[model samples]
Target: MVKIDRRWKQVVRENSQSPLFICLGEKHEVHLFETYFKYQLREDARTNDVYLIHYQDFTDPLTYGESLLAEWAEAFKSWPQGTAAWPGVDFTVTTGTDAGRPVAALAELCRLYPHLAEQHIFVQIAPTVVSDFDALRNWISDWGRAVKKGGISKLKLVLTDHHKHQTYKKAADAVRFRIETDLTAMMQHAAEFTNPKKGDPEADYQQQILIASNQLSKGNYNLAVAALEKAVRIARRQKLPEAEVTARLMLAQCLAAEGKTAPAHSEYQLAITAAGEKNLVAAQIHMNYGSFLLSQSEQAKAKTYFSKAVDIAEQIGNDFIAMECTRLLGQLSEGILTGDAEAIRYYERCLEIAREMEPEKRRQSSMPYVAGILLKKYGEKSAAGKILDEEMRTLFGENWIDLTKKPKQMK
Candidate 1:
């Protein structure tokens, strides 16, 4: 029996030089193929000089004759010569097949200019159903030989099929790697917050939101949106009013991130209506809604929502929320909502709250924003400079004052 582990690793390493192989069995195998090459490219830092060629063209094979190789080759040739030597590397993709046409074309070009082959890497990925396995293997062998003769360092053949093929098993040993998906990790992490002993509608709702948050962090926005929507439905079904409001607000935030402003606004409006009173979660909803409106350039509407949040924060006696509300109120007052006097009032209130908080939390929470507002609006350049310097000394105890310079505005 082949020591499958050692054999797979050896093939993976050798193929790193000129890996030509087929992936057969399951729709999952295509995802695996993509993952394997992605890992290899990232590991070797060959991201710039990696190519992916799709052979089947589309779901319909009738339109499969389009070859992108000639265009890719011409474009590669037009690039500044010797770009791939020492400082640069280029990648090219090609598709379609008239048996050995692409391989032959590449071989001829490599023979004409050996350095071009050395500097560039080529990849060919064909759907396994279209061509006979024997013919494909023979072509790969011929192409591999040509690649070796031309002194090319890397070439890869990726063949994909939905069903296991006897030909692949007979000719090539299967190499596999597990790929992590955002959805899988999210579900696993959500499971952590679940407790049968403390099970309740609120706990379930929080767990769902946590899962959605994880999905968002992983850049799976669609999944996050879906999860939030489901959480809302679950909360409503269970008659958990607070959970329903929170879920709707979370959904609004997710939609805003996706730039779906109209729907997000509608959701935020629904959340505001549902919240009904001064509550921590409701205040958060108002704050997020206000921020969203500001981002959308609805400054007047944003100010109304921010003012509501500020009132709720004060009612709840939550200084953290009050501080945030004040900071945002100050930001809005600078231009969006009101005049400079209002801006200064809000800033001063925020500064007061920040000062009253524990020193560590104050440093972490509000000093940076306060310093920024002073510099930008008050034009207290020296005072802003001094405040930032002194705060860093007292809080971070580091002379990282130079790190706080404003970024250049883009035209």
Candidate 2:
């Protein structure tokens, strides 16, 4: 098997159970289609046979699909003499010049070979083949409905275009949850909060916040921001400072995600003011703001806020916040400055905080922190490293993956 790119492997591993994947990217440069085909071949070669179909070869959509059934049937006839049983096969179809017809072909293929839907199949479509964005979007809307209507099995559709527009964004938003387990779970949880209880005046405002969370998980930042804004307005009208602060914090997150940096910063400031300096909510706001700053490449500002948060958390005896802040600081020290002394101190404090917390509140992955410290203080071949590796293997089995290593790419 060949090595696969880290991002590609992460996607595949996380979505192993998902029936579909929609990857939208640049047409000429990204090479998302080719990379995905190679990655899937390497990842699933042991269990399933992989085939690629260039859909442009056939003029008619029905004929394009018929060829696959014919090929699949022929494979069973000329089996190797020593084979134990009939082998299963998966397919990847790519459409270039004839992108308009491939969707029909795919839907027909699914109708004929409903059994093959159980295996992972990939498809690549060239968006430029369409006349305009409207055409492309119409194609996508139709295609999405067909898939949801139980037309395809395991399909990964890669859209290669020179540039992405609103159509691409909408398509990605529609499918992101299927590709990410955490998001799918979050969406499910959010659905429970969608309806307010009868005669509960506060439930409406609370519902907005919960629904906003669902939109955020779906990557619909604009919708999330709008929901949070409505929640904040309701909270302010009710004179509920705590609820307002919570709403504002979420509003800031959505703003930041949408790349509205100035508005995000203002929202964070408003939230902090509302929570007050010594409050636990203030500490949380500081931590969240620090994370935002870190994402924006403001390390010094992030460090200052992290320090403030840790100080407040220590005063309030909130071990969870302290543990989290210290861990973040440790990551920064180790990753950015490579400052072993500071990083080790922060990590040790984090571990101490974790140990002191109640079992239910404690995070179970402290061994990785110790392993990280060992890797920094001593080389991979050192006694500490050997001990850490052996311990990790004992805990997670012999094939445990190393957290520090980058996934290999195909040469």
Candidate 3:
């Protein structure tokens, strides 16, 4: 083990929970513009709480060492780092090539804190640092002496407006990190919050929702359910009511697909209670529940939910849901409604909406096909023909599809 100096040890103990940053350079120049660095960092700290340690140069090494240690001790004297259940972010941005103790210090930080590999970042804003191959390589390898084995994340190569970082640019890209000339917006994020503020919980919940959505769409039901459980916890902890409703709805759908009826129904009830009827949320949940009921052969119960979906969709003027509910209602009418009038009315309503719909929405798949068959079966050829004509126009160019020449089985 490379023993840390007693001064650095105090810093490690006191400030480990806050993200640690070290600016590396030719010793004097880095500390020369320390004022400007402090100005920019102070502005950033308003949004993020970073425990920044800017390298200071004193006239005497003895005074510099004493002052630096005192500064750290004073800063965290009362603030507890607590037990390291969640070791916070570790970040670094080097401006000059100090291929000495500063580099070795980084190696030590990375070795002791494995989370550094995930959160530690390097921003090459100045040319002198990456101008020398030896210095650049040391940075790329995190000073080539991590006890956990040497490695580093992508180096952010900030180009001068005159584009003087061509060498660094090519090298960074060659190593698989595409160079970014603008680091202002990204600077605060790399130095992200130590706690779960700065919208991290919401961001994590959103990411999980995206993953769960794609997994569900791809029929990976089990994985989707697992992802949704995480999303639900994050949403609840963050006190995000809308996001919780969305996560629970998808969670219920996944459970229903997996045939976990009891749990699926429980999730549905929770979501529906949170999102009362007459809202779009209610419309969506009811439609999903109705589909689940249909899949389980509870057609009578399914129709009730589908009817509720139609009412909510109409109240909110959401034609998309209206179209789905109407189509399903028409299909269910044949088996349960005791008369063909309800079926004809549902099909006619679908056709009316389909006519007003833009061709791109492509409502033809449900309205035109179902309406044509049902109206014709009831010997209402003229009404069915008009709906069929609109379908042909919507699905194909007006002159492309002619129902008259279609085979009997097609009608």
Candidate 4:
């Protein structure tokens, strides 16, 4: 089970809140639910009464997929809605992992009984349970519509995803949700006025920004550029300097990934100026700008930005970002950038920091990163090799990091 992040723990302890946990795979997901309940009790001894539907009751899978939802909804309508004993009983609905069937059924139930909106908390534990083959995409879209159209109540949806996984409890959460929260309020004014104020372009701009980021993460640079370019236009037109800076930064990242040095550099400068040195986004801007410079073989310039990022990351106590930047710095130090003794010293220092991370995190990220950089630098008849070769092989097995072979890719 994943550690209880404070954001999630807040959600779990929320009295009268409902969580839909998703569990799927070849075996049982005892951990997710067990952890959920354990944390719930630990956070609040008097956790709200939860009306849980494990949904082992449904066995039929409509070969067509659509019929399953309809049928399940019909069967589930009879279950007790929160005990009418409490006038304002908070109700939660949860489905861990295998959310396709549960989602389909829940959507139907919610649509049939509008009263549930007042008390319903729909929890999606591990939303990845709904995959492409499950035809769950349409179900998810319909569910979102239900929540948005006021058919499911005016309350905002509670959503979290690995991609859109956000801790909305943060200060930054306000900007994104603010536009959405105020739209209905804006509608009231529109009704009284002869003309509706132009639609809030930030709404669409935010969406485009999200799309662009997703595309970039998935290695779809061209599509990311397209979406980000559109977002940039909307941001500038709407006088959203922050949005413009964010879009330009993302666009620069895409451009750099595509190996377009000159334009990427230009965008980085414009975005850096817009974000200023002290903005929270400065760390990201510097880190990414460093990567862009490194990609263009501007190793020295890259090193400076990386160092700046390290400083901000340290100030902010973002060890993850600090480690990643340090890793990149280590790469540059030894890999054709400047194989000086100072670089060698930095590599050893960075490795020490990596080793200090939590065991799982260190193994999954830093260990591989440090091993790759060292092997690339010292693995080939190199002075660094003769000194650290035995130690490096011990850290990463010979099979995993082969020093004798030419490096397959630049970091």
Candidate 5:
């Protein structure tokens, strides 16, 4: 199973004060329960005060009240009235019979022992209650209303049900559950959030774009396309310019990956126009377009776009992108224009810039172009040959020598 790391704990703790809804599958309930208990214990340790209210059996309300009243009386010597203890901490237990009657019970508790209700921390355990879709919605709405009006600091509702229903799943803020017996499969399912709903549609659309990009990274092209399409529709509906541009770019990449060249080219053009000038997206647009043009044997047009990308990258002080653009330009000019000395010069410049940069993936990516330029300059026969050989080995491992086949038409 994937371990819940410190970062996950931080996220949950930060949101602890807020209303939390949870739905747990049977297999995972124990894990969720343990985590929840840990959170409470942590908070209590920090605050130096903790109160727990058990609601499993409430056969007699008077008996429950007497126990709570005695506890409160001992905590505060003389019971104060009204809103004096409004911000203090108090945990009150309630049963399934009290699930729909939270407000009424709260009012009764307040009238009888005003201090306890003034500083209420409700721990409602409704084991026998069977909540439908409407009940779930109403429960959440009521919880929100109580917090807004009554200034309730914490409200914890624990439901003991055999089957996990969609209603509870949708209402819960974050679910804490365990995975099944297969740890790998459990971890995978745990990684997927049950709720994808966002408060704002535009924000949700942007999230979809990110999800699509992640899917693309995993080589799930069809899923990526579907996500991108949904993101585009949402962006259009919300009139979010940045999101629309991003969706277009992602769609273009998906199309290119699928080898749908004509449509991909059209999409790239749209992305370039939508991204406009003086933006990171615009720089990427130029680079992608240049790559496409180069693949189609339009070296001159591709060179112009690559140069534009280089300029933009320089303006933004993005040395990696500048190096890549410069390298690509050199490749295009050399491959299609046949040993163009100017292309060799550009490649040399890229190498110089790359040498100054930190060691990273981009630095590694630039090595091939540097080797290509050396091959162009020294005719694969001089000291340049030794440099190329060493670089290929360094970049592509020992098999590099076997894989170093010359391009059929190195114009």
Candidate 6:
């Protein structure tokens, strides 16, 4: 449903009289324009015998003309030569060929079809159809002269290439397709030309990560997973453990989100193992893993990971991890409703860390929830309730008691 470029329509229209039309620009743009051109031709009432051929599909360039003739013979079987409905024969050839191969193929076609001289033969090539500009110009000129001698009606050639050349401009009606959109399709299409074989595998890996991130943001989980998989492979090949860990972690999260728990768990373990003794990342990964397990209701396993995360956080002096892991541990403990002293201790330790943080950070502390638990478990006159109420009042304004909403099952 993407619209073709307006300038391409204008250029094609303006060159209606020209027997040769050469499109030049980026590969995707030219390819898209080729589709638009074909659509325009098919819509015309005067056209019928339209065919498209990928030149690369033929293994041998020498047999290109013979192969094409065989294909056309089949078409002729379907629609007789005298049929007005199939009068003009039009072809769109997408090739990575230089001038010589196509010129030779055209010669063979002319030799085999003597009636070609008496009919209009239109051909188009997209993006990288020819190399050696001077050779192409000479071939076109020589072909035109030879076809003219045979009383040929008109032999049209539409060649597209990546570069602009004066010889091509002089030999054919050349039009350039400019890249106008920076959307996802265009971005992905552009990525198709990135050759990791040309050295710089890291660029390809980075591109995959970027593309995966974009896909993730668009909620295309399958595509994101595919891209991250490629990124993981690339990182492994590049011998970059950090990159591998990053990709695996992202892949794990994506798989987990999609409910593919087994693969997600595998990727998470791979990431954790790859992280090794990198405490900062290890702590964060353990906490995330714990959160994932908690979501799956694996409370015992979740507690184990949260405990490891807490130990690592304390070792690394990472207050963020310490606060988060401690809070999570408290939640897991309090979920049992066993009035465990351990749960209150975890919550108190988490609040102590949060209190030292900035006010903005302190507001996100688990202390408020601890107050709620204390209020629900015991009367306001209890020692724990009085102590928490005084602190909660300072954090949650004068209506702190009202702010405490008891955990659902606690009541």
Specify the highest-lDDT model's number. 6
| Residue lDDT tens for model 3, 167-203 | 3343322222121211222223333543346667866
Cα lDDT of model 2 by residue, 215-265, tens digit: 786688887888899989888888888899999988987887778999999
Better of 4 and 5 by lDDT: 5
Residue-pair clash count for candidate 2 = 2
User: Could you tell me which residue pairs clash in candidate 5?
Assistant: 21-172, 21-173, 28-178, 338-411
- Rank by lDDT (best first): 6, 1, 2, 5, 3, 4
Q: Worst 10-residue stretch by lDDT in candidate 2? A: 402-411
| Cα RMSDs, all models | 17.0, 15.9, 20.3, 15.8, 19.4, 23.0
The per-residue C-alpha lDDT of model 2 at residue 360 equals 50
| Residue 93 in candidate 1, Cα distance off native in Å | 45
> Against the true structure, what is each candidate's TM-score?
0.46, 0.45, 0.44, 0.41, 0.42, 0.49
State residue 273's C-alpha deviation in candidate 6, in Å: 0.7
Model 1 C-alpha lDDT per residue in residues 291-408, reported as the tens digit of each score? 7888788888888888888899889877777887777777667865456888878877877777678876775676555656655565645776566456656765664444344322
Clashing pairs in 1: none
TM-score-superior candidate, 1 or 6: 6
Name the runs in model 5 displaced over 4 angstroms: 1-199, 210-226, 236-241, 257-260, 335-337, 355-372, 375-411
User: Each candidate: what lDDT?
Assistant: 0.61, 0.61, 0.55, 0.54, 0.58, 0.64
Best by TM-score: 6
Candidate 2 Cα errors over 4 Å, as ranges = 1-200, 214-223, 277-279, 334-339, 358-367, 378-411
TM-score of 5: 0.42
Q: Which rank order by TM-score, best down to worst?
A: 6, 1, 2, 3, 5, 4
Local accuracy of candidate 4 as per-residue lDDT tens digits, 1-411: 233334344443452222222222111223333345445434354434223322222222222223433443454455466322212212232322223333444444455555554444434322323334233333333344434443333222233322243322231111121101122233344443634445658666766776776566568888889989998899889887788888998788678779886888899998877777655677878887887777677899998999998888778766667777876776677645444556656666666766677766665555555655565556656776655556556655665454333223323
Model 2, global lDDT: 0.61
Candidate 1 — what's its lDDT? 0.61
Tens-digit lDDT string for candidate 6 (165-231)? 4336566333444433334555655566765255477877877887887788668999999999999
Clash pairs, candidate 2, are 27-161, 117-153
